[model samples]
Target: MSSTEHTSLAPVEDDARLPVADPGLGEHVERYTDTDPAAARRAYRQVVTMFGLVPLLAIAFVVVYFAVPQDLWVPLLGTHWPLNNLLLGLTGGLAVLLVGLGAVHWARQLMSDHEMVEERHPATSDAATRAAFAEKVNAGVVDAGVSRRGMLLGSFGGALGILAVPALVTLADMGPWPTAAVRRETIEKTLWTEGEVVVNDVNAKPLRPEDLEIGQLVNAEPASLFDLNGHDYLTEKAKSALIVVRMDPNRIQIPESRRDWQVGGILAYSKICTHVGCPITLWEQQTHHVLCPCHQSTFDLGNSGVVVFGPAARSLPQLPLRVNAEGYLVAQSDFTVPVGPSFFERDSRNDYQEGDQ
Candidate 1:
């Protein structure tokens, strides 16, 4: 034959063959475990041993969750690593990993090594055909020898069950719900009482009218904050914090009813924003605006602390100010309205009655 020409051979007719002789599968070679019963038993033991360790690792996860101190750290890679997080991740991850490796080892050595293929069938089969497929699946599960592997099944169940304990135990850290009085006293009211001296937040000294310059904004807190002890000091100081800003008396907009709330154009409003209660000390003296650093909700302190821009829904709660007997700026009383962010069940009524001063 020429180099470009090919000879055609006579087609052979066989069962389910096309116009050609089929080249079938390769010669089968058995594994050592398949031929020797002892080797097969050893490999099965190896797989079961791997699965058995999964439960031990899972138990270690529980131990690490409770025993390891969260603040404890170790130096590595020029930085400290949290021992609690490290141990928890290792124990939990190794538990799942051991189970996967055991199942893979069992399939490779002890399970059936024979290879088979099926001819293409119709995409949508009859009900009888689907029923036959389901039966084949059940038969395959039985052939995989899981039905006789009681140790693997028990250990797998035990390992998976212990995984839930860590998550459920950590749920206790969310803390208890606030009582009605605790909610009102903590968030709605502050330490500001009648004639409570307005002190500088930095030096803790009282602010006189002469101490403030025009367009000056100072972060302030109630002088009563000095008398409180323990957690009450921080808690009351946070709620009673103020921004005392002085603007030109003619330039400021003081509503007719709240005229006495100012001391020579020096007014104090809450340092906390009504939008999610972020600390707002970002002052724009020229525009008379205070911006929340978290969400950029702007409020006009020169006005009645009105919401001039951004996402703030309500006006900043104004703390009524008065010049006391010592010429020191003092709070006339607590805020007339609730301070901070709004909630569904908050009592919005002004709790400060007319003669409370």
Candidate 2:
């Protein structure tokens, strides 16, 4: 036969079978609990015991959550144990697992175990069949004796209640907002002032204009950072940071109003990244660009620290600098504008009216 005839003949033979065998089902085995009251009662007690333990484990989980400090660690074998995390996770996980296991065990061993075979039927059941299904469900619920088992009901409810404690405890860290002192002294101001000396970050020496060569860039900080009190040390160190770069005067594009802001070829700009406030010092001598290592933000130092590339939204802040009568580099005044990342008030019309100078 040709391939087309053979293919057509194969389908015809397959279609010739009008009926298929119905395997029906095999014999169902009766469980011990089905015939014996004592065995059924024992299974009931075992399921109840597992459910009862869940509430106790949940309570232990709450206790561990509150009592353990977050930083506490214990060495076990060669691996370090985050004991607090380990204990809390294990107790809470076991409580939930036990509750599931108890429910499954009770359904299999103690509740109704009659084997049922549901024959294929039409898509929609008639009213009589629907009523019979509801009746069977109600009968199963009655046989389970869930309403009469006060201990199981109470223990399961308690376990669910105790699980909410960890969520409440975590909400405590949300805060009442920054303290007034922190808001005013740290966030709003920095160590830079009229006479604060600008010191080289590397050797911590005072900077002189003569010390900087053409096309040189130096990471710098305020002298007051070394003597800060309490949290001021970190606060001042973060905001008062500066980057000193020198280029030929002819290569620079200084605004007419900022002509006196630089001493010789040396200019200073805030080292804080405008993108997200990382301390930036990476420099490219030929391009006169200072790059932030965090997100590769590039700023052209010869053009008032203009952002040349990457994600930074604004230019790096320029710090007005001059030589004191004694020849040490000092800030001309506090930054005219706030020095870090942009905020809601920063771009408001009222803030821009104040101007960068």
Candidate 3:
């Protein structure tokens, strides 16, 4: 059609046929790096420098992982901070941040500056178009100048390779391989020992058989736990904490093997649930059952602390109890078995029925 005829057919104001105006790409301006070789070299160096710092930060992460003692605390803000965690986080975070920043900086400062719009087309492409698209990708890579820049390639590769070391070295934290000796020295034993008095956890006073009446339950811990401070106190208390309960001797079943483990009708058992280490706090006086509030695992305190209901797999570990010369309850020895949730090394045979020894 002629230009005048096209102008005459163009939609007027408020016409339903009015089309949206196309905002064409604006003028392209050359960057300093794009125009000058010296500027381009400097931009390349900046990105390489960023990538180079990532490897150093990664190395620092590993060094901090080994050098910093886990228990060492430093004051930060108004509170104490774990120095090991602080240093590791700082170094590891910087390493990852530098990698991302370096890629962004490289794309903006050193890669292609020309802009082109991609038109939407059918989703399925013919085989010839697919081949052409692959060629275009290769051409784009050439335009990016990645294959030609040895320093950028090497520095980026080194950064990513060194970053993996942090994860690999941390695998060491999982080991020394939880051998039988390590298990025995650690998870299998507690602060409770022969002659260690069982003290009421709240009052911190020695517990006597008379202190607990029938159907009464008292939360108790080893007297030796008071000697420890901070982490040691919590750690020992978690393993050695006990619930002392007194039941009618005629009503409860006393296993032949554990006959002397209780003093009179008072028995001491680990307060920790065998299912997932929740504390057994809810008490059923008449039934002599103690419930774990966290998961509702019930243990029959009247019948050797066996699992009477819920998901608990093993019976609660019983503490051998006897009266000292002073008439206060004392532990005859550490618990015969591990007390908390079942572990890989835990003996399932510890679970017993009424007739089993």
Candidate 4:
């Protein structure tokens, strides 16, 4: 037969839509709790117990949040750890974890276990379908025994409600706004005071004029800084860190007002950069300029620590230096102005200028 005749002879089916055959759900397997009343009650207790722990953890989170100092450290596994953070994380994390676990346990062991199959339908629902869906939700809640199991419902609700407390209580840290007085008492203040001996930061020995040669720089800090421990030591050291540099007496400009501020052509400036409070470490001996490696802010130490280049808006704060009775370098007083980065409360007008005498 010809190919066209052969194709026409093939059987043809009608193009009418037909009803789909139902693929019934597979045989249901009964759970141990479904068959035994005692097992169901035991599951209820287990779920309730898990939910009950969440509230206790939440309370612990709050207690750890306030009672433990952030700086308090405890020895753990050969290293000191922040007790506040460790405890807070443990309590808060477990609180959330228990809530999730409790819900899962309740659904698996106690909720309706009958298998359900949803057939595809139109995306949009009519008013009747929507109303029916809401009724089904109410029925599902009843099947979960929410009304009958008051203890389970109460524990779950309490756990969920109290979980908000840890987050809310921490908001207290956002607080009363840093006033001028607060600035003076905290970040603006350092350990330096009159007669505080300058010490080599590396060796912790008091430094003298002879310890530094002309065109040489040494990183130093207040001798009193060594007396502090833990957070106090770290806080003070950040603000009190200094760099002592020396140049030829005839080579650098010394303002008449600051003539007595230096000792034998040696001077000291804050090791912190003004731009973003990075430590100033890189030094140029010939130019007498110290550079901040972070943003390349350069300060001319020979000319009152003026900003010769880069993004620093203010000069590196100079520390007034003098010789003590023991012939060691000592601070005349605290810095004339606050050091490090500027803040809203600071009086920038009082900051040292290049031409100020």
Candidate 5:
């Protein structure tokens, strides 16, 4: 069509509404870094320096791990510390943390800052429209000016490079090998060694077989806790804690091999819960069940301290008991198996070795 004919054919003002005028983008404001290239460069250098230092800190973490002996002590706040682990952890953590800070600073101070407009479109588009969108994204990158910012790019790269240091250092920190220190010292043994007298928790008095009545449940601990020498008060109390429960001898189901393990009708069990290691005292006298309040785990005192309910997967650990030369209640031996929750590498077969015996 001719231009004049096309103009004549176009809708007049009365037939069609005029399109809304574009408001255009907001007015651009120059940041301090934008106006001062020297200041921008300084900021970029500071970020790069932080990233560069991160790898050094990470290397220091590794050196501390190997060079510093685990048992060596350093005086701090009037207390001696085995500083190898602490120093390694701090240096490794700081290495990764500094890299993150450096990257954030580089992006905020030296990277490009601009605004652009994008026209909205329908959700579904044809193949040609999608290809055009990809080109627009590439154009957006040019507008962002990333390729022109050499200092910012360098700082970003350095920051990313340093982040690997902490990752490698942390792997070493995880372990040389698994340590069973806590299990061996705490769970496998208690205050109830052979010949240690059993003392009532309430009155701190030594108990005889006659002191307990049928269906009576008493909290007890090793007699060593009363002594001033040969043991620390806290350590003895933690390792030797126990609960003494007396029931009808006929109603008790003592294992065949453990028949003489109890003194009269009184049986002793570890106070530590088999669930999550809380001290369990909540008891049901009629059912001979002791319950843990922390997670509601219940154990049957009359049936080898077996777990009868709740989240506990194992029974409460049993302590062997006997009478001393003076006819007072005493421990026959320490707990045979580990107390508290089951661990990943726990020797279950060894634990159950004498179940039928």
Candidate 6:
């Protein structure tokens, strides 16, 4: 066809025989990075630098993991946080942000930005057509112009490689292996000793039987827990928790083995639920049952903290109580049964006589 006979570039001719052809695409506008070589190089360097810092952040996260204690707290946003948590959060957050920013900058400034028009086709494709599509995709990958870029490739690899820092450092939690004796001392026993004073959980005052009336239940912990430093205090607190209850002496049934486990009408039992450890404080005055809110495991305090109802399979461990010369409630001994959830490899010696837990 002659040049004049072809369709116009802008507007269409009114003649139906000389119909206007579709405008394939808009003109490719050159970006500053594409037009200026210096700008492009600067952007590439910036991306590589961002990715390079990822490894340092990852290393810092590892250092913080080992250096900072789990219970260590620092002030931020008006709330105390563990030093480990603060550093890990800062480093991990920055590492992720840098990775995202680097990828974005690389795409915007360094990746080839060319305008191309792909003709639309039907969704389904023949085998030969699919093969052609795959070939074209590989060709596009080559056009990406990153395979030969050593700095960019190395930086990206380093960022991804050090991503395992958080995962590896978290494995520390599975460690600090508790030897059988350590396990017995830490998880099974609390700060309660033969004469350790029972203190009010709320006011920290020494508890006496007089402080409670019939059908009254008060949360109590051993006085020795107050002396422990930070993490030790928390661990002891979890196991040392006690619930002191006063009932009519006639209503309380004392086993032959546990005859002297109460002082006056006050009896104490571990606040931790045997089924699944939840700090159980929900008491039933009428039924004399203490309910675990977590799984609704009910233990009858009137009995030997026997599982009276719900999902509980084991009886709550009772702490032997005595009145010291000061007329205050005190522990006769540590809990005879292991406390908290019945984990595997626990002190089997303390299992319930009633049945398997």
TM agreement with the true structure for every prediction: 0.63, 0.62, 0.90, 0.84, 0.65, 0.82
Best by lDDT, which number? 4
Question: Model 5, 335-356: lDDT tens per residue?
Answer: 8888767778677664432255
Per-model tally of clashing residue pairs: 0, 0, 0, 0, 4, 0
lDDT, model 4, position 357: 88
Clashes, model 5: 4
Ranking of predictions according to lDDT:
4, 3, 6, 1, 2, 5
Q: Taking the tens digit of each residue's C-alpha lDDT, what string does model 3 give over 118-198?
A: 899899999999999999899888777888787877887898889999989988978677889988998898988999999
Weakest ten-residue segment in model 5 by summed lDDT: 348-357
Question: CA lDDT, every prediction?
Answer: 0.81, 0.78, 0.88, 0.90, 0.78, 0.83
* TM-score (C-alpha, index-matched) for candidate 6: 0.82
* Tens digits of per-residue lDDT for model 6, 1-357: 876787657765566645766666888899998899899888988999999999999888888888888877778799887787788889999999999999888888887787787778899999999999899888766655567566887788789888887778788778568788877766777787889999998888999778899999999988877878787878889988999999888887777677788876689998998877898999989889899999999998888888878876778888999999999988887888787777777755655444333
Order the candidates by TM-score, highest first. 3, 4, 6, 5, 1, 2
Clashing pairs for model 5 are: 190-239, 191-239, 191-240, 257-357
RMSD of 5: 9.5
What local lDDT score does residue 12 receive in model 3, on the 0 to 100 scale? 58
Q: Compare candidates 4 and 6 on TM-score and give the better one.
A: 4
What is residue 215's positional error in candidate 6, in angstroms? 2.9
**Tens digits of per-residue lDDT for model 4 on 235-278?**
89999999999999899999998899898999999999999999
Candidate 2 Cα errors over 4 Å, as ranges: 1-21, 35-39, 121-136, 172-273, 276-287, 290-312, 317-355
RMSD values for the candidates in order, in angstroms, are: 8.0, 6.2, 6.1, 5.0, 9.5, 8.6
Once superposed on the true structure, which residue ranges of model 4 sit more than 4 Å away at CA? 1-24, 65-86, 120-133, 171-177
Weakest 10 consecutive residues of candidate 6 by summed lDDT: 348-357
Query: Which residue pairs overlap in candidate 1's backbone?
Result: none
